[model samples]
Target chain A: SQQGEEDPQALSIQEGENATMNCSYKTSINNLQWYRQNSGRGLVHLILIRSNEREKHSGRLRVTLDTSKKSSSLLITASRAADTASYFCATGSYNQGGKLIFGQGTELSVKP
Target chain B: GAGVSQSPSNKVTEKGKDVELRCDPISGHTALYWYRQSLGQGLEFLIYFQGNSAPDKSGLPSDRFSAERTGGSVSTLTIQRTQQEDSAVYLCASNLEINTGELFFGEGSRLTVL
Candidate 1:
């Protein structure tokens, strides 16, 4: 079963703008992670926020996790044309034995 | 190797035939995963392996699907009697351990069943 669902299935923005995507899950998680995939190929890890962390940042990527709401959001500041890709949120729980259930993902297109 | 590696990046096979996809994870990584992605679709978890423990096979969609990880390093996903519905990109990923952090993914194998 899918544990996470991302909102705004698709988003288009101009370069230099900011893009925000949200994800909600069904159960408690050990951690939530964000990944970027370009051209439907390999996925690159972006950031990971543990259940105890409310927010975390790496470069221009900011991720926030709200365990109470069973939700999380990813914010990409100063979006670039190169940042155009699909972002996925994955939830990892101890009961899952290390398997991370991913969301449907948000496709972000940045126009130059 | 420096990263997770998958072989036969692309495979075109006839329906009812069996196909096997391979994955070689980053050296020493104890956790590996298999996921399937259809065109424009999110990943669907297939299976997971952790160390020498019995793999978690709950995510596998059907009896036709099975996987095995040998020596806690390499894995192979086998789809028996493939159907058109099996056509998708099979992705392999590995992590250091359970809940340790991010996963390293391979380029993935694209399978086309006709």
Candidate 2:
């Protein structure tokens, strides 16, 4: 079973526009991490936010976690055409084997 | 000196044939994982191995799928009597330990069952 579900299965916007994707999980987690996957390629780690943290930033990427709501969001500021790809949120639970459970993912397209 | 690595970047096998996929984790990484991704779909957890501890095989879709890790380093996923529906990209990832949630993924092996 999938632990997380991402909203807006697909999104399209201009290169300079900001892209936002939301994810909701079904269980308590030690942390939530986001990954990016180019077509036909392996996933790349983007950001991780621990349960105690409310917000985190890496380069142009911003992530927020609302443990009370059991949801998280990733914001890519000033997006580029190269940023077009599939974004997934993986939930890691301490009680589990630390194996990540992934969401369906959001496909973002940035038009030049 | 490098990231996780998988063999046979692409594979084409006929239905009913058995196939094996391999993964080489980064040196000293004790945790290895296998996942499957269909076209335009998120990854599905397949199995997990942590050092010498019992492998967590609960995520495996069926008994036809089995995996083994040797010396807590390299791992292999074997699918017997493959079916056309088995076509998907098999991904391998490694993490330091159970506490570190971050995973480093390798270029997956794209398997197409004919």
Candidate 3:
């Protein structure tokens, strides 16, 4: 079963614009992490936000987690063509015992 | 290796045949995971190995799918009597330990079942 569900299955924006993607999950999570996949092959870890923390930022990426809503959002400021890829949100829960359940993912395209 | 490594980047086999895929995680990492991703689909959890403890095989779809991690360093995923539905990219990832955060993934092995 899928724990996380990402909104806006696909997004397209011009370079330099801000792109936002949202993910909602069920059950209590110990932490939530975002990953980027290019060419549908290897995935790179982007950022991780623990349940105790509300927001975290790394470079142009900003992540916010709202446990009350069971949702998380990823905001990419100053998007670039290189950022075009599939963004996935994975939730790690104690009940799962260290396993991370991934979402359907949001395909983002940054037009140059 | 500096990162996770998977063998036979691509594989093609006929239906009812068996295939094996291998994964070598980064040195010193104690946790390894296998996931399946269909074309244009999200990753589906397959199996997980943590140190020398028994693996969590709950995510495996059926008895035909099995994975083994040798010496807690290298892992192999074997599928018996493959079907067309089994065609997808098999991704291998490894982390430091339980809830340690961040998983380093390999380039993935693309499987095609004819």
Q: What is the interface RMSD of each candidate, in Å?
A: 0.9, 0.9, 0.9
Question: Predictions ranked by TM-score, top down?
Answer: 3, 2, 1
Maximum-lDDT candidate? 3
**What are the per-residue Cα lDDT tens digits for candidate 3 across B43-66?**
999989998564578889999999
TM-score, per-candidate, Cα-based: 0.97, 0.98, 0.98
**Number of residue pairs clashing in candidate 2, backbone atoms closer than 3 angstroms, sequence gap of 3 or more or interchain:** 0
How much does candidate 3 score in TM-score?
0.98
Candidate 2 lDDT, B19-50, residue by residue in tens:
99999988999999999999989999998999
Q: Any residue pairs clashing in model 3, and if so which?
A: none
Tens-digit lDDT string for candidate 1 (B60-114): 8899998988888889999999999999999999988867989999999999999
lDDT of 2 by residue, A1-112 (tens): 7998999899999999999999999999999999999998999999999999999999999999999999999999999999999999999987766689999999999999
Q: After superposition, how far is residue A78 of candidate 2 from its true place, in Å?
A: 0.4
Candidate 2 chain B: 10-residue stretch with minimal lDDT: B51-60
Error of 2 at B29 (Å): 0.6
Off by over 4 Å in 2: none
lDDT of each: 0.92, 0.93, 0.94
lDDT of 1: 0.92
lDDT of 3 by residue, A4-98 (tens): 99999999999999999999999999999999999857999999999999999999999999999999999999999999999999999889987
